[model samples]
Target: MNAKEVKEILDSAKKNDVFLMEAVWTRFFPASVEIRKLLAQGEIGEVKMVGAEYGVPLFHVPRSDQKDLGGGALLGLGISCLQFISMVYNREKPESIQASGICLETGVDESVAVILQYSKNRMAMFTCSAGVHLHGEAFIAGTNGIMEVLSPMWCPTALVVNEKVTQYPVPEPSLPLNFTYSTGMRYEAEEVRQCLLKGNETSAFCLL
Candidate 1:
């Protein structure tokens, strides 16, 4: 289905009293909660900047060539990066957005790079590609140190303060597969339940 059609379906479901939501899974997980806690407790200090990227090399796929299918790096991966930025900054929209990309044969973007500027001199750099394998990592830089989230989409395992560029101990595992890993999706669902219980429509963590 086209992007517009998908949006329409979601709207219809919402109107019909159904819990219709886009499956943006990262917002509901343990990593997100920990990140939120850190931000709240000033663990990483004041968040000064954010950088994230997501990309995949879909070179020869037919659906990847169709603009009508929302086939492009911007829609595919850029949205995820944007979501990360939005979540970290408390769902505030960027004050300004500057984006550029390359259009491939089927009039779909092959790659894109965007810069989003937010309040308090905070900014985020985002990139996406359908032409190359991406090393997806997200970093939130603060006054004290930095918080690094590896694989922001699926398993957002976080890293604590690395004081020096010297050697550091191996990071411990954050979640177990199917058990704790599934907590990501469940956390988000619980957020929805809490919001409804509180007579709210949107979640503070995963607001769209």
Candidate 2:
């Protein structure tokens, strides 16, 4: 959604006095939580850059090439990289964004690369593709050391900081799932439950 739409939704939710949350599930995962904790503790010193990539062969998927269906590598696959970058930056606005993409005949992007420039020399770079497969890893580089999220970073179960590894598996799902690590969704649900129990109108981690 655009900025105007997001603001409108936030306003409406506030006016209605109802709780609002965005299901950015990764933020609720244990590994994701650990990332924030480590950053806060200065485990890697001042973070200067974040690099991420997530790509899969989706060109054969019909919806992926259709503009009306919101089809595009950036929207369908790249959101993960974007979300991770946002989380690392705490949603701070980037001073500039540079992007490039290769579009399909159907007018949707098939591959994309982006660079988000933030203040204090901090920056984020990422790439996403619908026609190719990528390792789906992510890296956060800091003055002291570097942190890395393993492959499939969007729903990662492991992280490496300064060559030390940590793993946090998701709870098993009650039923079959179409996506990997979808069981992590339970974490997001529990967060919502806790927020409501506390009588909060929004989640501090993913407010509208």
Candidate 3:
């Protein structure tokens, strides 16, 4: 029941001359994008571990805690946690992936904690919860130092690079409204627009 046929879509895009990509907006966030650059510069000195957690009290929310209703922690909040891992590693092949979690009344998963072991002893640990509120923060910890993303890591504008913290002003949405983390959604859209206009199917940020 995996609706996203990523490889199929990628191949189609190449053949049809049309652009296609997953809507993983987190990948376009300033904080997530910067983390990759900083890592390439060896800012973290070879990331050995990545820890991220995302959760909220949504156990009663039908889309999160009801199996027949497509309820599950992994689909609801786990993608963001896994995004942190993808930001640091090539997930095409993991050395090993271990998962354990709890099931809600509807037989759907309420919480999931995953451990991804990779080559060179690199590893990642992340958790998603539909029953409680986590700090909503994520980090990339390496041998030299650690990079901490701001809360609600999914749409963060700031990041704490080692001891020095850097921040970006929350984006103002086109349609004025109270503050929303999703304001950063524009970054993703704009990246896509520019990519298509340039006739480039992908870029570092847009490829994934």
TM-score of every model versus the real structure: 0.77, 0.94, 0.88
Worst 10 residues of 3 by lDDT: 60-69
Worst 10 residues of 2 by lDDT: 1-10
lDDT of 3 by residue, 88-172 (tens): 7855467899999998767878889999898998889999888888878988899999999878788887799887889876676
Give the Cα-based TM-score of candidate 3 against the true structure: 0.88
**Candidates arranged by TM-score, highest first:** 2, 3, 1
Flag regions of model 3 displaced more than 4 Å: 1-16, 174-179, 206-208
Best lDDT among the predictions, by candidate number: 2
Candidate 3 colliding pairs = none
- Model 1 lDDT per residue over 113-153, tens place: 98889988988888899899887778889988898777644
The 10 consecutive residues of candidate 1 with the worst lDDT sum are 162-171
Residue-wise C-alpha lDDT for candidate 2, range 1-208, written one tens digit per residue: 4689889998999999989998788888899999999999999999999999999999787888899888999988899999999999999999999999998889999999999999999999999999999999999999999999998798889999999998898888889999898888888999999999999999999855
The parts of candidate 1 lying over 4 Å away from their true place are 1-11, 152-154, 163-203
Which candidate, 1 or 3, would have the higher TM-score against the true structure?
3
Error of 3 at 158 (Å): 2.1
RMSD of each: 5.0, 1.4, 2.4
lDDT for model 2, please.
Answer: 0.92
